[model samples]
Structure formats: structure tokens, C-alpha cells
Target: MRIVLATTLAVAFAVPAVAAAPARPARLGLCAACHGETGMAQIPGAPNLAGQQLDYLREALRQYRDGRRNVPLMRAAIGPVSEADLDALARWYSAQMPQTQGTP
Candidate 1:
């Protein structure tokens, strides 16, 4: 019966891990690809996000997430993020120093 006991323990431990696996940080890799690591986007047509107003940035993300603003790539990028993550990103980007002074 030792084998049965060990199997039961293994499953009991594994269930929590499996349930917790999906709690990863909201994936922002796509944003970096276009928007750059610091929000100074390099890809064509990607807007610079550094030092943007907090409210504006937050609103844009909210719109994209909810389909209120339908920029296909942006919608796709933010598609899986939660509202909390959107706020976090807005705060991060808004805190960046603008590439030029007297901006944002």
C-alpha cells in the first residue's frame, strides 16, 4: 500500500501546481517587439509611449482591451491581459522619461 500512498501524495501536490500554472504575469513580449523595452517603439507606426500622460495611456489600453478602439495589432497584443495589468503597464510607461525634454 506504500505505492498507493505515494501516488496519492504526488497527485495532491501536483493539483495545486497545475492550478497555479496559469497565473503567469501578463505576457507583454509582443508589446516589446513593437514598442521597444522602454516604450520608444522602433517598428514603423508604433507610437512612442514614453512619458505619455497616465490617463491617456490607461485609456488607450482599456479601449484596446475591450474593443472600444480596434487597432488590430494592439487589440491582439493586449487581448489576454487583465485590467490590473493594463493599469500596471500604464503606470510603467507613463513614468518613463521622454526621449526629448519638455514633452508629456
Candidate 2:
């Protein structure tokens, strides 16, 4: 009986743990299509995102999300992203090491 009670308690505690995995970023594939796998923008006119400030990135995304900034492409690109996804993307991009090439 004691063992059964202990097992039930353990399972109860473990349930929340199993359910608590961090939510994966949505729109990450769209982000990667232009930003590259590491957040370095590969397309011309796409701003480099690697190592950018989190606050700045978040603000920019917010602007795009809210129609404050007027880039149609960017607005469309960022439209579907959630706040948590923006935060996660900003955090992920800010940690990348930026590389620079000579100006063409």
C-alpha cells in the first residue's frame, strides 16, 4: 500500500514535468528561408539578424507585427509569429557569432 501511494505521488509530480517542454518557435522555417539556418541573412536587402540586440529585434518584430513599420514583405513575414516565438527567435539569433565578408 505504501509503495502504491509513493508510485502515485511520483507519477503525479512527473506529469507536469513531461508536459513542460518548451514550445518550439513557429515561423522559424520562414525566418530560416531568408535568415539562413544560423540567423545570418543571406538575401540582399534582408538585414543580418545574428548577434542583434534582443530588445531591438523584439521591437522590430513588434513593429512589423503591428503595422508600425511599412515593409510589406517583412510585415507579411512576421505576421504569423507570436510574442513567445519572437522572444525565442530573438534569443536564438542574439547568441549566434556573426561573420563579416569584404564589401563587394
Candidate 3:
């Protein structure tokens, strides 16, 4: 009984502390200009990226970087980014909780 109680207490205390500090990509500010800090789109035509699949985000970033996607703004924004930075951006955006309602 004591062991179970102690284990539960440890997890309860530890989890919130870890969750409270959100990990973000270094270039999140750049994305946040169009995509909000929480991954919601701030600009009129920008798409929301929160809760997107990890694979899709990575692939999309790659396509944008490589100019296959063909949006000039996206190409410019992503062109100079390294592979590791792209992956980190993808992971960060994918991990965000998406909005529930249809419109922002």
C-alpha cells in the first residue's frame, strides 16, 4: 500500500512540472508570424498546423524547402532551414493541441 501510494505521488507531482514547461523550436517565432505560437494560423490564408501528423508535417516542410510545394512565401521561409531544424519544427507543431471549433 505504501509503495503504491508513493509511486502515485511521485508521478502526480512530476508530470505537471514537466508538462508546464513547453518545448519549442528556435525558429518558432518565424513560423509564428503566420502560424501562431500555438500552431493556429494567424494570417488569412495560412493553414493551421497543430495536431497534424508527424509524417505529414515533415514531408510538407521538405516539399516547401525543396520548392516542390511551389508557394513562394513558404519556399522563402523554409529554404535556408536545415534538416534537423525542419524536423524539430515539425515535431513541435505536430505536438500542439489543435483548436476544436471550425473557425478561429
Q: Rate the local accuracy (lDDT) of all candidates.
A: 0.77, 0.79, 0.88
Question: Which lDDT tens digits does candidate 3 get at residues 22-103?
Answer: 4788988889999898889998989999989989999999999988899999998877899989988998898888986574
Which residue pairs clash in candidate 2?
A: none
CA shift at 46, candidate 1, in angstroms? 0.6
Enumerate residue pairs that collide in model 1. none
lDDT of 1 by residue, 40-82 (tens): 8878788898789989988999899999997888888898678
Least accurate 10 contiguous residues by lDDT in model 1: 20-29
- Give the number of colliding residue pairs in candidate 1: 0
What tens-digit string does per-residue lDDT give for candidate 2 at 1-104? 99999999999999996675334465578888898757778798777887888799888888888899998988888887788888888776766668885789
- Global lDDT for candidate 3? 0.88
- Model 2's C-alpha root-mean-square deviation from the true structure amounts to 9.0
Which candidate number maximizes TM-score? 3
